[model samples]
Each structure stands twice: as structure tokens, then as C-alpha cells.
Target: MNLKNKIVIITGAGSGIGAATAKLFGTHGAVVVASDINLNNAQKIAGDITEAGGIASAIKTDVTQYQEVEALIANTIEKHDRLDVIVNNAGIGGKEQLKTAEHTHDDWHNVIAVNQTGVFYCMKVALQHMMRQGHGNIVNVASLAGLKASGHNLSYSASKFAVVGMTKSAALEYARKNIRINAVCPGFTHSALLDQLLAVSPDMGEKLKRFIPMGRFGEADEIAEAICWLASENSKFITGQTITLDGGTSL
Candidate 1:
């Protein structure tokens, strides 16, 4: 899959899957716009790409705010004259894990605002531009939790499931317009988010690893490869589907 000269925007590009993806796309000849809530980290990744002779720019953005998302798209157009691809990868887990009945209002609302509503903001603006241009691609970073229920991650699961539904619904509407929309559901990936959770319960990682048929957690680059394919011309006919990158754990 070739992404040469593609103007790509990746949110949560500071670390983990997003960072890995930004680098991969850069190497594939994309002009990457890396956005994250943390300006410092975003700049770091962008700098890394630049040092490696890749084109990139960093923008500090909070996806929950519609205006920021609007500006993110606008800025990309201002810089590149077109928006070619977007990876809605910014997401958060509950501040504290909670059961369905125990979820706090703050935790539930925050998770949905970032994971669900954030995707909506990016897609809405991107579709408007893509419709006018008559071509574009959007890839959302959902989770395996979105596909199946997991205890104590209620807020996150709810937001991701909404993303799954939204991906399909949007794909169907825009397929004829040449705008392909899809989602990636990553399972037990070794990311900063996973490390933070593992730090709290060290043995949990090993316990979770046992469930995967491959007996391993996915690497960030592995997930990045899938995102790149979904955003590339190679997936010209693929849309409205959730590509699960689990190590056969769901089966």
C-alpha cells in the first residue's frame, strides 16, 4: 500500500500506536500531521520524523473540543491544501476501573467525550471536505473491548462500541462518495496505556497473555501496519468494517 504524498492526520500521536503509526506513514512517504494533547511529545515525534528525512508537523489538540478538531482539519488544509487521511486514535480509559453500576458520572462522561464524541467531530469535518474533493479515508482506533464485554471497563467499552457502530454507519453513507471509513480493534497491545494499567497489577499482564492463542501481546507497530493499510489505496473497496488485530483471543 502506497501513501506517497498523502496528507495524513493522526491524533494521540504522542506515543504508542499513534506514534508508531506516524513514523510508519512518514516512512511510506506521507506528509504526517501529528496532533496530541501534549504538544511536547507531539513535537518530539514530529522532530524524529524530520530528522529521518520525513515530512511532519506537530499540533497540540484536544479532540473532545469540536472547535479544536475543526481547526485541526483547517490547519491541515492551510498547510497542505488537502486532507487525505485521518486516524481517530485519541482515546482514554476510565480514571478508575468501575463496574456498570459503580461508574462515576465524571469517568463515564470523560471517556465518552474523548473516545466517542471525539471521533464524531473529526469525521464530521473530514467528510465535508472529502465529499467536496470526492475521495478520502478515515480509520478509527477502537478496541477488542468494543467487540466483546470485559468486566470493570464499562465506560471505555461503551465508548468504543459506539465507535464501531458509527464507523459502519458512516461508511455506508459515504461509500458511494469515495470516502472509506473503517475501524481497527486492537487486543492487548503493549502500549503506554497498558503499561500504566500493568504497573498497578504486575501479574495481570501475564494472566491476560495466557488468553491470547499467540501467547503474546501485540506490538504497536503491528497495529500501525493495519491502520496504514486501511488508510491506503490498497483498501480501496474495504469500508464500514472493524478489522480485529487480536492474536486469536476472541475466537
Candidate 2:
């Protein structure tokens, strides 16, 4: 688990699980490149890491834009000279914006653009770099919605399902090339996304926890731990798999 001097690029690093993961990786001695559409938030997170004596840099990234994603990857490589880990965690929970089939086109399109296409773009760029390095780790942050149906969450589920599919395919294609790809499917994690979902269905949050049997929502750190492990050599033998950190909710 010693990631000293490792170069890592994390998307959606502005807030929520992505932010937590970025900080965790940085704290573990990884030189982290934290990217987010919100440049301010990204800068703040990177600043905090630096203040704590962790190596980190911030960059503005619109994951849906291939050019932006490519630039982010290129910048990371330019600054660090090599990329060791890529965490494609940039995504949106459309549980609030995308309510039904008849929802606004803008809402639906935005979710798909950010959640699905963004992941694809990140993987493509990261893989290109990793292929040259002959070794890399890719961890895509998917969701339980990718595995099960979550009503009123059309765009979010669709995007996550696509991510799961892409992760599996990429993993198989790169297994022999020394590149590992995996997905972490979290359920009912505490974040802005969850807050939006809860706002829509106040009691649903409590009900959702009941289904987990653990009777509680998960912490962002819980998911971050999974990402960190998957990104490490400890998971060298693991790939093309989706690890669920939902306190047995999917069971």
C-alpha cells in the first residue's frame, strides 16, 4: 500500500467521494492530480492537501469534453512524467434532475454526458498513457444502480450501467498488458448526490437503509478505501470486477 511517489489522476475531485479519495491518496504519499469542473473546489482540495504536506495539483476538467479530459491527462503526465493510477470518479446522480422519461431534455442529456461519456473519455486517455508505461490501474466509480433498478433515476442508472460494461471490457482487453481495470459500486453513500435523492424522498433514505440490513448510510471514506485498495498492487490479481461496498445491501 505504499504509494510513495506514485502519480495518480482523480476526476470529480472537487467534492463528495471523489474529494475524499483524492485526499486519501495524497495522504498516502501519492502525487495526486485532482481534476474537477469546479476549478475553485479543485484548487481548494489541492491546497488543503499541499498544506498537509502532500504532493498535489489542481486542474479544471470537464470530463464530458474529450479535449478537456485529454488535456487533464496530458497535464498530469507533463507534470509527473508518468501516470500510475487513474480514478474515473466524475459522475452525477440524476435522481433529482432526471425524475422520469418526460423530464427536461437538458437534465437527461447533462447526466449522460457527465456520467457515461466522461468515464469513457477518461478511460481512453488513461489507457493510452498506461499502455505506453506497460503498467497501470483504473478504477471507475459506478453505483448499485448499475446492478439494480432504481426508479426515478433513469439517466444515472443508464450511465452507471454503461460504466460497468466499459470497465469489464477494458479490463479484459488490458489484462495481459499489465493494466488493471475495475469498478466500485457503492449504495446509499452520504454525499451531495445522496442528499438530492433524500430531498426528493425524505423517508426513502431511512427506508433505503432498512433494506441494507446494516440500517445506515455509508460514509464517503468507505468508498474511498475501496478505490485506494483497487488502485494498489494489493489488487494486482483483481480486474474486470465490480466490488460492492454497500454493507451487504446488494446481498
Candidate 3:
């Protein structure tokens, strides 16, 4: 991937896919701004990259807050003088598996706030800068649930569906402006998010793996590779598409 010297921001970068992507971006010679709600984790990732001879920094951002999202973009631009790519990878799953009728309002709101609304905030703020700069790329981290039906998590499904929708819509709106927007829909990836799911239903991992044609969970670095490609010039002509990395489970 030709991400050399690109100034990139990744949300939810404290761990999992976000952390993997940040490190990958660093390796590709991009200036990585690892943003997360957890400042310590973000700092650690940044520190590791710096130690490895890559340029990186950590920014504490709660994506659910618009002001904080704005500050993230503003600070990056103020320091880097240009915003190249932003990976809206921050998201949360439902607390428990429940059917629509049995889903609690609080869980629904919280999930939506982080997954959908938070993505919107990042895009809205980043777009302003990109539009002014007349060039940029966006890679949103949606899920396979966003592409297909999720059995029991209505909020997560709905919010990710919104992300897919927003990615395509914005891609079209900004296509002529030299801005590209795309998404990666990962299925059953081995990340903290999946661990949380498995923690809730300890026996579900094997059952879920059985459905995948590959018969294994995806590694976070695998998804990061795709994200880096999408953000790089190699995929410059691609936009408004959701690349699925699900071990063929969605097939």
C-alpha cells in the first residue's frame, strides 16, 4: 500500500482491529493518530509504533461526543496541516443477545450512539476538511451484520446498516470532489469485540466457526490489511463499496 507520509486518524484504536490498523498504517509510513476513548491504550499503541521507528501519536476521543469528534479532526489538521484518511472503526455491540421485542431501550440507544451516530460525527467533521482540501479517503469498519441479517442483535445490526448506507451515500456525493469513501464488513473477526460476544455466550464460538467455510475466526491483522488497501492509492478508483472479510461465512 502506498500510504507514505499520509496523515491518518483511526478511531477505537486502543485495541482490536483499530490497534492493528494503526500499526499497519505506521508500517506503511503514514503518520498515525491513534484515537480512542481509552487514552492509555491509545498511547501504548502509539508508543509501540514510535519505538518501532514509525511516526504516531495518541488522541483521546469519545466518538459519541460531537465536540470531541470535532476536536479530533481539528487537532489533527492543525498539527499535520492536512487530513488524509480517517477510519471510523469505533463501535459497540449489544450487551446481550435479545430479539427485537425483548431488546432494552438503553442498550439500543447506547449501541446506536456509538456505532451509527459516532460514525456520522466523524464523517461529517472529516468531510468538511476533506472538501476544503479537495481530496481524502474514508474507510468505515462496518460488520457482516451490516450486510446480512443479525439474528438477535437489532441495535448493532441497525447501526451498522446505517454505516453502510452512509458510506455509499457520502461516496457518491463526494466522488467528483476527489474524496473516496468505502467500508469493510468483517465477520466474526478475532478482536476484543468478538471476545465480548464469546464471553456472553461461551459456547457460541465453535458454533459460529462451524458456519464459516474457512472454519476459523479472522485475525485482526487480516482486516487491517484490507483497510490499509482501501485507504491507499492502489484502490483509488474504488469507493462506496463494502469489502467482506468473513471467511466466506456470508456465502
Total colliding residue pairs, candidate 2: 0
RMSD of each: 0.8, 1.4, 0.7
Per-model TM values vs. the true structure: 0.98, 0.96, 0.99
Q: Could you tell me which 10 consecutive residues in candidate 2 have the lowest summed lDDT? A: 93-102
Error at 127, model 1, angstroms: 0.7
At residue 145, candidate 1 shows an lDDT of 93
What candidate 3 gets wrong by more than 4 Å, as runs, is: none
**Where does candidate 3 clash, by residue pair?**
none
Please say which candidate is ahead in TM-score: 2 or 3: 3
lDDT by residue for model 2 over 1-251, one digit each (tens)? Answer: 76778899999999999999999998899999999999999999999999999999999999989999989999889877899999999888654544576666676789899999999999999999999988999999999999998877888888899999999999999999999999999999999998887786658787777898788899999999999999987878999999988888888
Which of the numbered candidates is closest to the native, going by highest lDDT? 3
**lDDT, each prediction:** 0.94, 0.90, 0.96
Candidate 2 regions exceeding 4 Å error are 95-100
- TM-score, predicted candidate 2 vs. hidden true structure: 0.96
